[model samples]
Target: MRTIAIGDIHGGLKALVQVLNAIEVREDDTLIFVGDYVDGWSESAQVIQFLIELSQKTNCIFIKGNHDAWCERWLRTDTVDSTWYLHGGEETMASYKDVSLADKKAHLEFLENMPFYYLDDANRLFLHAGFTSMHGVEKEAFETTLYFDRTLWEVALTLDKRIKRASAFYPKRLKHYEEIYIGHTPTTNFDSDVPMNAANVWNIDTGAAFKGKLSGIDIHTKEVFQSDHLPNLYPNEKGRNKN
Candidate 1:
């Protein structure tokens, strides 16, 4: 079966629908969404609804993202953490004005139960962010597997002094298991439209929430489909604003 991976949808439901229609995914094929499914746009609730339906429509896997994690916390407690809101949770919360508590709870459970990482028989690992290899560290603990790998990052920050210690840190070590597909960190490096590296590790989060574009990669063919949203689509420029 053909496998396709879609990047962060954020809350751009229009872009999401366009990309899906463009792909023309078949029911027999498998589609894996690499998280950040909500936030950024005004249709967070609609996005969640679409995903729920899509899950039943075919063989699909919804991996959790850092944004997805905070969304759950916000829905459950009704208070958002600064770190979470800073990364698009605000837009998500603002989008859910009509959804019922029952629906929200169901969505929250779906978000919370999301797998941090997925490893195929061929060793292809699908994670929302990064991975950490340590004893007793559940795939969920890496957080980076669905958020960011702070521990590995903290070590990277100490490079000057760390280099003196004679030890090397290679986040690439996770590559040994199988290729990893990640999101969260946008491939675009601020203002640039170019996507980040996806060779050794497939990073599908093409910054759809930003001025860049939304992308989906066909795993088998390694082909990428993207949708751009630069010029305003709405006449008054209401929700047509870029993320």
Candidate 2:
């Protein structure tokens, strides 16, 4: 049974399907989604429904992302005044505009219960954004794992770097058991595939919200699959130079 870790979907159900098709997932395999399931695209409802159904079919680990947290806040409070509404929340809401209140409540409940981080026996940690010093069920109750910023990213990055340096310095006696798999940050920021030692804490979020490609990574093998709509989807750091 292989483990496949997919990056942020951000409501791009079409792109997700394409990646799934490319992978040929099996019932015995596990699929870990890095979060940001909603917002950006016009298929938030579809994305949520897909997640619910997928969880039942396979060993699916759903980690909450910042956008997911925002959705939760909006749902639990009935107020759309959070940062989510400002980002891609507007698009997410539009997708479910016709959904019934009952259905919306059910979806929200599902999101509320999702884990902030998932740790496997193999020592791989799956988190949406990243994990802060205050993770686990205790602190996660207040802030979703998806929303952790510098606290999580920096420490994780530092630890990752240390591990790599150690491995390069001592290949035979490698340390560190956990491989951090994170999303929220996009690969577009860097030139090469982000690899923190064997712990490929990849940021496959090619920025679908900005029309970037949707990406998925296969753990163990370290192979990556991406949507074809990469170039046309999002504008790069440099604003569009349209004619």
Candidate 3:
């Protein structure tokens, strides 16, 4: 059984569909999602809907993203966060404008139940974002760093790959995990549009919400699959609005 980790979708339903269709998933295979399943594009509702159906097929682990938290707050309490609205929340709202009340409620329940991280038997940790070392702290801090941290990726991107290989911060930040997977920060921000690696930390968020493609990688093999640029597939919508 293959364990595949998928990056942030950011409401790119077309890209999501294409990537899922290309992959070969089995009943025993495990699927891990790093989060940010909603917002950015105008297909947030559809993206959630597809996930609902996909859940019925195999083992699916959904990690909560900051944007997912924002979406649930609005769905359950009717309180609109102005910050969310400024950062692709408007586009997400537009997608659900026509969804049925019952369906929306179901989607809310799904989002509300999402976890912040996943630790498997292989000692690999998956989170929406990895933690930053403060005074040199381990990367995983319950769910706090799992959803909000960017230091894990930041430090990895800044240092030379050789430094990571020789002296791993995995023990400091990732605890006992052999490897870690994360999303949240787009790969485009690093001026690349592919999955990146630093020591035992792997970043698969290829920025499908921006000018990059949706990415999926086999956790064990590092085999990659990608879709077209999000804007190319979604011509009418601006993938993300700068806040």
Candidate 4:
């Protein structure tokens, strides 16, 4: 009955599978994926298919990512922005070149239905990116910000919680959750493969889209599970090595 929050998969199905195997999910356990499930490696379609199947066997929450939004657009219109293609969309489309119509439809529906954010009884916020300010997921404005905002993480990284408590200039609702878990900003930016926490927010995207591993953490116990570096799993691919 553990609650696990997984970082971005970014089409690294092998890494995703390795982390899942390590988790040994139980019947009542819940899995929360922070999104970016596609647009990297060569198995974006396979990753979606696995997730579609996994949803039937276990409790799972899939949060839509910016990359996923690109996928949704392409899935529906069959055309997408060149920016997406440059940032791994080509590989993603290639992964599904031979996919069945039914599978693509299923994947499309899945992406379309994905919520921007998820909250639990423990008051933990799970999102793909960052958010401005919202009490409820329904009240979210500009859903893309949930997967694109960097300001929140920057504040979390620099803000002193004690000063925040004492400051009258800041809103009382500055942090409305016990913990916030996000995945858009990779922890690798901080030169770490493990999860990084600033204030009460946790950055778990350990750059699996690049030369890093896929990571998953037990939200309640703080137990972490990580897969091998994706470049090793995908020897022929360069992934997203920022120049």
For each candidate in turn, the TM-score is 0.80, 0.79, 0.91, 0.94
Model 1 C-alpha lDDT per residue in residues 34-80, reported as the tens digit of each score:
88888776777888888888888788898887778778888888887
lDDT of 2 at 59: 86
Query: Model 2 over residues 1-243: C-alpha lDDT tens digits?
Result: 889888888777877888888988898988888788887766878889887887887888888888888888887887796566767777777878888888888889889888877878987777776543333423444554445553444454445445553465422211233466777776544543333322344555666555466777788888877775633443342111122
Kindly give the stretch of ten consecutive residues in candidate 4 with the minimal lDDT sum. 165-174
Give the Cα-based TM-score of candidate 2 against the true structure.
0.79
RMSD after Cα superposition, model 3: 2.6
1-243: candidate 4 lDDT, tens digit per residue? 899999999899999999999998889999999999999899999999999999999999999999999999999999978999999998999999999999999999999999988989978889998877645444557777788888777878887667664466443334577888999988888899999998778999999999999999998889999999999999998777646
Write the number of the candidate with greater lDDT, choosing between 1 and 4: 4
Candidate 3 matches the true fold with a TM-score of: 0.91
Error of 4 at 85 (Å): 0.5
Error of 2 at 182 (Å): 0.3
Output the lDDT of residue 87, model 2.
73
In candidate 3, what are the lDDT values of residues 1-243, reduced to their tens digit? 899899999999999888877676778988899999998988999999999999998799999998999999999988889998888889988898999999999999999899888888977988898766542333434556667788778766666645544365433554446888999988888888999887678999999988899999998888998899998998887788344
Q: What ranking emerges by lDDT with the best candidate at the front?
A: 4, 3, 1, 2
Positional deviation of 227 in candidate 2, in angstroms? 1.4
Q: Lowest-scoring 10 consecutive residues by lDDT in candidate 3? A: 133-142
Task: Name the best candidate (by lDDT).
Answer: 4
